[model samples]
Target: MATNLALDPSLIERAVEVSGEPSKKAAVTLALKEFIARREQRRIAELLGQLEWDESFDHKAERSRK
Candidate 1:
């Protein structure tokens, strides 16, 4: 599969240099994959945190049941 994306040249160059990949394409692919993985992990954590019931909510329910 082939896709065209326009990325900053300086950023791409930095990724290639740090990755030490033989080609720019390889560096870009690796960088993009890592970025996506990190972003997804953060999003999942945020969602999980939001789903958890707060202590205040639990206390309120206990009081109401008394």
Candidate 2:
């Protein structure tokens, strides 16, 4: 899928410079991939943390019921 959207030229310039990708498309792709990976990592960490909390709660509840 392809979409067209306008962005601030200054931001695009900075991204292109830092990425050294020579093209706006390449810079945006790199940045978008990094952004998605970071979000996925955070999400996985959060889910694991929640699972740990749930297991701890289950153990506590079981002990109290005995």
Considering every candidate listed, which one attains the maximal lDDT?
2
Tens-place lDDT digits, model 2, residues 1-66: 798888999999999999999899999999999999999999888887466344445666778894
Alpha carbon lDDT of each predicted model: 0.88, 0.89
TM-score of 2: 0.67
Which candidate should be chosen as best, given TM-score against the real structure?
A: 2
**Cα RMSD (Å) between model 1 and the true structure?**
8.2
Q: For model 2, give the 10-residue run with minimal summed lDDT.
A: 49-58
TM for every model, in the order presented, reads 0.60, 0.67
> What overall lDDT, based on C-alpha atoms, would model 2 receive against the true structure?
0.89
Clashing pairs in 1: none
Q: How far out, in Å, is residue 4 in model 1?
A: 3.1
Off by over 4 Å in 1: 48-66
